[model samples]
Target: MDLVIGRSRSAAARRRREVAERRTRAIAAAAGVTTGAVLVAEVLRVWRRGDAPLPGETEDVVLAAEQAIGQTVEVAVAGYKGGSTRENALLNLHLSFLATFVLTRVSTRLLRERGRWGPLRNVVVGDHHIHHFVPGIAMAFLAGGVSIVSRDEDLDPYLAVPFGAGVALTLDESALLLKLDDVYWSEEGIVSVQITLATLAMLSALALALRVLRRGEAEVLEHDHEIGHGMPGMVVPVPSFP
Candidate 1:
């Protein structure tokens, strides 16, 4: 009789687990579909716009939005040094990566708390919990591989967005990867936050330095141009330093 009861309890537990897994998967699928649909709609709308003016109030709103975005970008990048296309793409990647990391961390914390934060929850399947880092690695790999294969400068900005997002996702769980165990939510998980902040600081500093260097170069070149134009028919001697 006890044995039969034990078996029944075990079966009940397994069913519960299975149900939870299914719920988690369903939630994830729904979120993914919704996000994809929104992205596609936005992309199509923008593509259709293609330099065409919107009607009346809509046109004014769109123009205002564009100007606001431009101003924000300029402020974010320290007065906008007028970087090359590739440099701007790189900046976008860094900013996107940082933003994604922050959002992922917040989302995970909300899910962990089991709050009424929609259907967000940890994904599990057959006694295995799938970490976000898995998808992150795959995304980063695919984006990087395509970028390398295509070798197209024009496509860098597009590829960089996904690459940045993937990197952020993976790094958000850096502690787990380093320890080879699920250390998230533990003391060890703090390492991941530390690493992320350090990375952000380094990237921000590097970007600022690059901008300063570019600005200095531009000033020097402008001065040289002024001097050259001011003294016509004068050949400037090249200075040699041993």
Candidate 2:
């Protein structure tokens, strides 16, 4: 009877473990979907509507976009349009971080579960095991430094790519960073996942709040332009909101 009881307990425990894993995966998938949707929407907005005013360019594109998206959505778009270069740079930084967080978690799961089925599992350099974080870190620093010294609007997206990748790699080994030891295969690895999610959530909320708060100002300025009171032939340089 004791042996039978032990067997039953083990089976029950296994089911519970499976359920927990499924729940975690579900949450991660949801986060990934949400992040991808936001990124796609932002990119589509830029492609379809163009960017904020550049030097020697008029604000017509921004105005048109605002009109197309309507008041609620337009307010945020307008606020972004009127934002300064520094604001745009900060936005790029936030997006890169968020993207990295999502991608790292998802990729780690995929590689762990499906590694044997694909060539992805064989990636290496000679006898040394290549860690994605190494290249990610190098790219991030290189691009980040370049962005800091220069204000080229076009460079922001380029910088975001490397920075995001670097962040993902580094965060995947978040346990190592905190404890100075490799605990990636242990429960401690989840620390990186938690930090990534928390940071992304906070940054996203802050960005949304800033945009929402700027709505009234954006509307007022837009109203001035509509009434023909806005400055004509004056070019205000601003970064793209993406």
Candidate 3:
């Protein structure tokens, strides 16, 4: 009887530990997927859309997509024709997205190089508090920094809404240590809320990429000799994003 009881207790403890691990993994996995997808999306958005107005590019996304991604089921959603100047606003949205990607990339680098200057993690940055508060917050600021440009892209900020919200929520959730996720571990889990948020974040990041490329092009045009290698449009300046 004593042997059986001890084994049972041990099994329960093991099960508890497994449960905690799954939650952690769920959050981290969500962040990773979000980040990667954002990167890809930003790359494409910038490639196609080009630059936006500075100092307010981000606002366009918020005005358009704020808290909206979760609300939309049909991929067609809104956000296509953002404002009175819908075309311009869309361009700015793309610009803000490009800048966001640059910032996210910067945060990733900090995780690697500035980990000591910031927080400590168990092989994963998102698992750490500093990752949430410091790097995550910085990225959030980039996301929140919007303008008429962003506002102009007023139709929908689908990617920005959920992506920003998810990062903020996940960071908070980690801090609170919510033991809500127990089933999404080491398996092909369902397309959860976290998953959707991550997708939105990825698309936003992709938009940022396009903005940066467009900005780089403008710079190259001003000083053509400085940049030795780039395509023709690579150096052409895009009008201030809508």
Candidate 4:
């Protein structure tokens, strides 16, 4: 009887902690959105006052970025089909963003209604609704920081998890960020869905264009394969990029 009682107490305590975590995450999300608004306002205020720093001043601020990241940037650039680091990063960021959006939509649909068992139950903490974006935001920063310092390309896939998660969470709160109020279930909340869909469409279009361009380049190379032969029975391998 004592053992059963102890187990019950532990479970109760764990439930309380989970409830507290959900509340904490909700508060943090609110604070983050508020802080972002204030920062944007500050930047606009400075710009209007003509107090913004010069373009060169901004360059100096990030001048040490290359030195700080060391060879990570080079490795990313080299791996990106011979594309520049900026291009590679942007492409991956968009792809991850779209993926996160799709995931959030599916998970939200599945977890909106409660169940007695399975992973969907994990979405709710006590009576409080826990957003997946909360964990996503944390993971994104943790993984991004690790990827920045590591030179291994194999670890790059791990970096996508956080980026994708954080993005989904942020996009779901898009209405909150824009209106500075909670309107997630109302008509206003629909704005978040619209924005997420539009962004994904644009990113998909860009990715398709890039693929077509790559295919065209490959076809051009194939034509050259026959013309570039120097000797009979000699085989040459084409170089691969990215």
Best by TM-score: 2
TM-score of 1: 0.52
Ten consecutive residues with minimal summed lDDT in candidate 1? 43-52
Q: Lowest summed-lDDT stretch of 10 residues in model 4?
A: 67-76
lDDT of 3 by residue, 42-119 (tens): 434432333322224465664334223322211112232222343433444444444444344345446557664245
Clashing pairs in 4: 81-242
Name the regions of candidate 4 deviating beyond 4 angstroms: 1-80, 84-86, 113-118, 148-161, 176-182, 204-216, 219-242
Off by over 4 Å in 2: 1-74, 116-122, 148-161, 177-182, 195-213, 220-242
| RMSD (CA, Å), each prediction | 15.4, 11.1, 16.7, 20.2
Q: How far off is residue 133 in model 1, in Å?
A: 0.4
In candidate 2, list every pair of residues with a backbone clash.
none
Per-residue lDDT for 1-242 in model 2, tens only?
99999999899866765665665667667766765676456534433433344324555766655543454355566666666655655666666666676666667668878874344563678897666667677877888788788968767755766676676666666676688766554445564455456456545745653664355345644565655643666676788896
lDDT of 1 by residue, 91-185 (tens): 66776787787678778878878743676677889999889999899989999999899999878878888998898888888889988998776
Q: What would the TM-scores of all predictions be?
A: 0.52, 0.55, 0.26, 0.46
Per-residue accuracy of model 4 over 1-242 as CA lDDT, tens digit each: 99999999899866765665565456446544754664354334323323234345466534333332332232223335555444455566666666676566556656555542355555557896665556766777777778888866666654655675676667676776677676654445643364446456444635643543344334433333446654457677899999
Ranking by TM-score: 2, 1, 4, 3
Runs of candidate 1 with Cα error greater than 4 angstroms are: 1-82, 195-242
RMSD of 2: 11.1
